[model samples]
Target: MKLNTVENLVRPVFPFTAIIGQEEMKLALILNVIDPSIGGVMIMGDRGTGKSTTIRAIADLLPEIEVVADDPFNSHPYNTDLMSEEVKESFNSQITLSQKKIKVPMVDLPLGATEDRLCGTIDIEKALKNGIKTFEPGLLAKANRGILYVDEVNLLDDHLVDLLLDAAASGWNTVEREGISIRHPARFVLVGSGNPEEGELRPQLLDRFGMHAEIRTVKDPDLRVKIVEERSAFDQNPLDYVESYRSTQDNLKERILAAQNILSDVHIDYDLKIKISEVCSQLDVDGLRGDIVTNRAAKALAAYKNEDSVTIEHIETVITLCLRHRLRKDPLESMNSGDKVDKVFQKVFQ
Candidate 1:
């Protein structure tokens, strides 16, 4: 029998392994993939630092996830928690749901998007007339179990930001209109990037992000030349350029998948956890989010590094990313907060 297939447009996304520098930003993105509960990453960097390119590359690098076929929510076939209400009901009724492996979604929320567009609207007229509930899913529904990227997120409308904060915080998007209600999973990695020159997100929205990664333009002349040459080559012949790095991409993809599989087995020491909290306390970070995200990010890094247990090295690398945005100070300032985190991490760990 001939195998059925669906061909998606194969954009020549730059290979994640081929991305030069921005190691902090790259690592933050990878950790979120390994554990989305690290919440998500707020990537602020200078223009032309490959911030958007890196995000897209990582999205392309992610492994395909098993999902219910024809499900708009990208519902997990067996995980009722991850499934849409309709899918769950069908599953509970003993329906044999069709399944397919799909690339994890990558949703780019346009700045001009309206509330109804971001959060699906209920078809009240149809529901009342036909006596059948009709709901139209939106970007949040489509982003379920994937990556929701909002470029220039600092400039997003306050109302939209409120909607995103709610969805990201609760992992669910609810739409109610005219007494018609619909809710669906909105659990996805919320990645936002903006140049500090543009503006900054409010502390509340900034703190909503689990980690903060700051990237800078490569300063080394040789490295700058290399990045330029690589981009030139990609633009010249995207397909061939991408193919040259296929092996490296496959290896990195395998590593990420393996890390995810072993993530649950990774453990952190109680003393180390205490030190993480101490570092947060010293930083004067508000609430327990900083401490919790630090611990989770540290564990994720250890797992990504193929270590069974967390270490100071892991904590040192991830602490800054986890807590920098949570500081009560201005979020648009130069990334010296990362240095402060390092300082406190050193003092606390000692």
Candidate 2:
């Protein structure tokens, strides 16, 4: 389908605020949105707990982005495009044109997908007709500067998972096939969801995710009924329902934008930094990514609170969401990182 047409047809259904519960999951996703450099988030949960719904809701919350027109990869205008001399000159000349903002691209990588489809392959017909190798961009290319969501990620083919991990870690995709060599920016926020009961993700891949969250099916009768009613009302008239929540969504967008502006100036004090490092040290997280994400998340919380700097309270609030999944998992023992975070905060901040 045409990109613009898809934008209109598949309007994001749930506003971020409209989601019922799963606060940690929601906050982790939002933190990623605030700082895509934090890597991505993996939502592991039981089925039918709004995992996919929360993803869709996040898509809705995101404000539109502007990019170069007619660039298949949605290449940023300021970025250098490594193409043939002729194509590069044309692109350089075209850079003077005005920019526009459209919805951020959100592409789904399906299970059972072939390597060729995920990473693109040579266009055989074009090669035969033109006597030149033509490269077809894949899902990763399409998801540039946006989100690449994988449902049932644990079940994904090992090779495909490896390809994703490589691209995500490097922020680039190099396609050398059929005697053609090409490289392009393929940076994107990777979101994956799967039921833990089904299987476990490879530890290497799991560690690549900046944060992890879980959700459970609501058992309360009234809350369940509320969820059903809200969904029913939304389905009955989606446009009207979206309209009703437009203000809420706009508010969230404003907050995100404000946070982006405020994030740079928000300081992580020395004492808070030491406290955060101590907490992560206590949890025995693997690497500095935990400390980095913890610091960033604390700053984001401060931005959200309109604080001038990250305080001990901000560190206390974000430590769990940032470091929970970074802890080593032991099948024999239950590890509630939340309780650990609470204990650390009580000891440090109190």
Each prediction's whole-model lDDT (CA): 0.90, 0.79
Model 2: residue 71 alpha-carbon error in angstroms: 0.7
Stretch of 10 with least lDDT, candidate 2:
79-88
235-339 per-residue lDDT for model 1 (tens digits)? 998879989998989988988988998999999989998888888888889899898898889888888889999998888888888887887785585757878
| Per-residue error (Å), model 2, residue 189 | 1.3
* RMSD to the hidden true structure, all candidates: 2.7, 3.7
| Candidate 2 lDDT tens digits, 1-350 | 55667656875477678888888888878878877777788898888899988887887678888776666677665556423233455667874734567677888999989988888887777877888767778998888888899999999987888898778767888777656676777888889899989898887778778777777789899999999999898888888888899888899899988887787898878977887787777777788888887888888778877788887767766777676667687777664766766676677666
Considering only N, C-alpha and C atoms within 3 Å, which residue pairs clash in candidate 1?
none
